[model samples]
Target: MDTDYDVVVAGAGPVGLTLACELRLGGVSVLVVERLAEVDTTIKAGAINTPSAEAFYRRGLLPALAAVQEENLERISGFMAQRQGGRGGPVTMPPRFAGHFAGIPLKGRLLDASDPDFTGAGPAGDIGFIPQEPLERLLGGRAAELGAEVRRGVELTGFEADDEGVTVHAGGSAIRAGWLVGCDGGRSTVRKLGGFAFPGTDPSITGHQAMVEMEGAEALGKGWNRTPTGTYAHGPFPGRILTVEFDGPPADRDAPVTAGELQASLRHVSGTDVTVTAVHTATRFTDNARQAADYRSGRVLLAGDAAHVHSPFGGQGLNLGIGDAMNLGWKLAATVRGWAPEGLLDTYTAERHPIGAWVLEWTRAQVALMRPESHAQALREVVAEFSDTVAGTTFFAKKISGVWQRYDAMAAPGDHPLVGGSAPDLELADGSRLADHLHDGRALLLDLADAPAIRAAAEGYGDRVSVVTAAAPGRPELAGLLVRPDGFTAWAADTPAPTATDALGGALARWFGTRTALPTGPRAA
Candidate 1:
């Protein structure tokens, strides 16, 4: 069949770019299109969660991200010193890694490397202050390096999908592809054009944020302002301000936000007449939560904000979108390559939709806890108490950091502990690591026991599944394991299964499609 590309990704943001990179790694031809001529730096998601960070590391992009974060740290320090009188006497600032949930800090102590629960979550280099702009640059550059065509200044005007392929109309040009994925923004035209059902709750509060010269920035202090009316926060820098008004969202949600409107909102929320001298950029957002009822509609699929959107309270939007791209990339590539087993592509929605719903609920819970009412205040106080304890703080850290997330490997195989979870970064006898083995975007039959039987079981899949005989002497709990392309564990055994060949054969067929040729020896050691 003649097609312009294997997949046409509508949107060139972080999610879209990451998806294009993954598809290319899987040997799929992809085209990424964005309406804007350049990357958008106005909206800042300043950090990534552990899983997204680890994904970048596995693809050999972490060192660049670490360099960007180091630069950002120095810039933040300088900004703070300049804003705070430049007095070098122990210039105290908030801890760089202390994240917040519902306006309360999830202290860095809980995320310490010593914690076993947090072990193997991600590389240490990824847990820093990397911002979104540099991340996009890295991802876009990597996608191009892997041979994905990215076309900016081209808008996806419309699309039509049939059984064979999808015809996308964009920028007065028509392009046919085997599939189309909408990684566009919250108000995605592709989503609307595909007739996907979006259902969710409306906004109960409005958030205003801006960088401006203010007269009384000092009184606002270094942290949050939880007043009787609303909440506001002035950061380590004087010009950066955030205000939350519990008033319902504005009538015109699409109206352009002005500095005047933000100033007014700031005064109302903070209950202070802080004079604003100048404004750089201002934007308004809402607590409105929504999700597409289905991620797939025929040949059209959705990811990122196009599939689900919620309050950015916990900074979960970007992380969620990244997870979606990674999860869908290999399955979609397998389908395009004519090797995907039955029901493999469908698992993308089944596995991810519930995770999307959980994030929406998480944000909703935060909104409720942040309400400026007596009951909400009492609840917040209780949660604050919990945050002060090790168990409570660790629980919150696990949830926020995404270290404890696990997907269900429905009807897959052995009920090993790591099933449906990310494969731990295991150290091998050769001093190499597990993630280092997966750089090529192929499933792994990691034979930790150096079991010849396991190697024999993986013989026929060839490049689709790589068998690795790594002596993971530290992880005595795992004799062998099967990990999917996206790093989630598919099956595991404490010892070789009684019927090793039959069991491994079932797993290979279920995940990587039937084998094409005789087995090559262990792809890596």
Candidate 2:
């Protein structure tokens, strides 16, 4: 049979499914092709980060996934670090990883665990983990519900593309689309076929994730406890423990690491001859460092591991992949509907490439510190208590939690309101949050009673922009906020100052372009 879609996405993993879901919501014809019959059971154990959650929230996927998770895990699981001079304790915990950048304000009291008001919700904060399989299934179902064509058991056999569109050859059939995205993971055929090269630093970490059903896990622990700097317990599940270690490396592709290999590692590390009766799921991996030289190549783009792979220090894998989907989804939709500047598509790479590299370099440093040499071990322990450099515990939590992702995307300090993380939850006069309002598929305008400027700033957006003047109670200084279709804060104006005024137009043109045409309604028909 032959099917032609607006976009054909390969590898129905979390990233691909997310892209499909968001595109389908925008009324874009999308297809997802996966060779596997079902989602895999092996878990990429970690919480879904705030930035990632925001990305999903933008697509209306977060609430559903959040409902399924065991609340949100918002604590920083400390890691040990070994130094060259002498391994000491983990570096000193800095203030809630306010940020690596010097001048950023301290957002958390790293030392004060009792600060109930404190929160770890930023690009660099803890994620909500509900297992990748369930997440993928949910995303797939959601995408299908939104009209994405999911073809399972369909292998990607070939592809041919030009400026006009992309034609995907899969499962002994032909599928065409305006664009093709490869979320297919490492060794992506689309990347290779598109001649996109992955050039970057070191190899990625090869580790296995196993759910150990300890008879008395609660008796042992609950959260990520210190098992020394070299290793740590991610968390003791109900009679279970999710673990990832720095193994040497996986063998060749023809010989992927198996359950038995993980079993051996468990026996060696845990010692005392503890028996691993069952393997929930086991896999091997390596090479913690790699990013595509760029994210785009003609009509084919890479997302998830397809575009970048790095040490899993931040639990960034799936989250980063989903972010890619969120970042590209609206842009793709606008382009297809004839509302976006062509250059906007290229910005995906410009915006995310540095982020990929930053995460990689940061993870590399963490890995270097995890070395188990005698002196290194001692230093890691001491530093855990004292050091205040980038290697400190405070920084580690913020870094890996993904709070450290500072983007040049928004140039001026106070320029664009949405420069940082997803838009903050602003309480409306009616108690509804600014976040809740934009859940409908639409571009949001947060009007801080600045009608003339808000409208003047937003007028060029045409019918494409649904202007909502958010009159934030009490804080009238918050003149306005621009909410992107994906739910991230694009522009926030505090009191409508002149310095930041120019940035409003810049921010709009950056993502949607000055010429973007909003749908007649929030939901694209």
Candidate 3:
């Protein structure tokens, strides 16, 4: 088969765009095909969580993301101000926005903004509230800048994969590539065509979300409110309403969501006769959790909603999808470049599958606690007490926001603290931060001890692994650490002596591929 591209990504959403950018940065050509002619203006997920926000920050996508967030806040603030001006002279303070787990309000972030674990080594906080359209556009623009081709209005009708490569049929044409990834979303054609098994629980409830002009908006309580019928939440944006009905999914999911439907759903859930005059956009979702048995089926793979899907509770779906893109991008790039070790591509499933399972369980557990039964309310009361405590809040915050997410990696003997954990944002000697060095999308070897052996070992890989000799006095754990491109530490040694060089070499081979045992000069950055 004639291969026309290294990878043909189905879906121009955030996950596909992120994967395309990562592949392009790794020198792999990517073609992203989407069925939609324009960016989906419908608001899907509302916020980028801490971990996903940090991922965007590492790729230098945060500046534009932050700008969009600020602009949105301004727009919402102006709307609120206009509403308040005509009513009275002054009003009490509005409720502060915070993260939530299930429908339970967090009151405040679990992770502190100043915490290194939360902010990484970056200057920004762990969360951003940019709407989905701008976020998708930002990722799409970044992917194009990195030479990833995105063609809209071309849908992946079907695909065929064999030992050599995959042939994707989209827009009435065949495009061949070494790999094909479906980021097309929950009802993924690539996933179905690739024959990946997606198994999980069925939906117990239907969720309705809409942005509209409401006549009885003042009747509903501010922020999230739990009623005996169901739960409802309102946002800062005027007429943005969220409602959940315990009824199973709608009969016609593909049918256009109308203002009347939203109004009815809101009335049932909130027990208020809220009138929706106009609906800008509306959609329905369910808690039908399911994950592909394998992320890859021969040469065809899945990511984002294609790979796993759970309830949008805690806003974890978008973040999990972005995480999938980040984790698979470099590994797939390595495979395409012919430098990846055996089973390297398989590790994408091995590593991410468990996380997906955990997310499914997380949402499922939340659903159990959210039932309108008396037992569930009692359990929620106990959980609420726990959430008010520091330990409880911190645990839930890290879990929900993904700050405590860790992967299992081969640890060096006398294991370093940060191994297999999300690498911290180290403050380097030259007034720069550790995340600054990862912008080029390469494995990073930080030599805080100024170890010639470690630096020389890294030089063997050349540009594949960047060696930075910087002093991170505050972080003694940075003595010598090999950070993967996705910002996870593969190996670390506190001493960083010549004896430790052998271990570092092994980790480099394990992650960045085998290299000639040469004593080259140190690379300075």
Query: Highest lDDT: which candidate?
Result: 1
Which of 2 and 3 is the better model by lDDT? 3
My TM-score estimates for the predictions, one after another, are 0.94, 0.80, 0.94
| Per-residue lDDT of model 2, residues 198-270, tens digit only | 7876553455556644332223333333343234343423323434455566556345445456556544444
Task: Evaluate residue 313 in candidate 3 and report its C-alpha lDDT on the 0 to 100 scale.
Answer: 85
lDDT, candidate 1, 1-525, per-residue tens: 699999999999999999998899889899998999998866467678888887887777777888987787776777678666787765544443467878887766654545675777547424657677788988988999999999999999999899999999998999999999999989999999999999999988888777788787655655567787788877634477888888788778778877677778878878777778788766677888999998999889999999998888878999999999999999999999999999888999999999899999999999899898889989999998988877777777777778776788554544666778888888888887888888888888898887888888787787688888888878877788888888888777778766754676677888888777765557668
The local distance difference test score of each candidate is 0.83, 0.63, 0.81
Top model by TM-score, which number? 1
Worst 10 residues of 2 by lDDT: 75-84
lDDT of 3 by residue, 261-306 (tens): 8988888888887899999988888889999999988888899999
Positional deviation of residue 82's Cα in model 1 after best superposition, in angstroms? 5.5
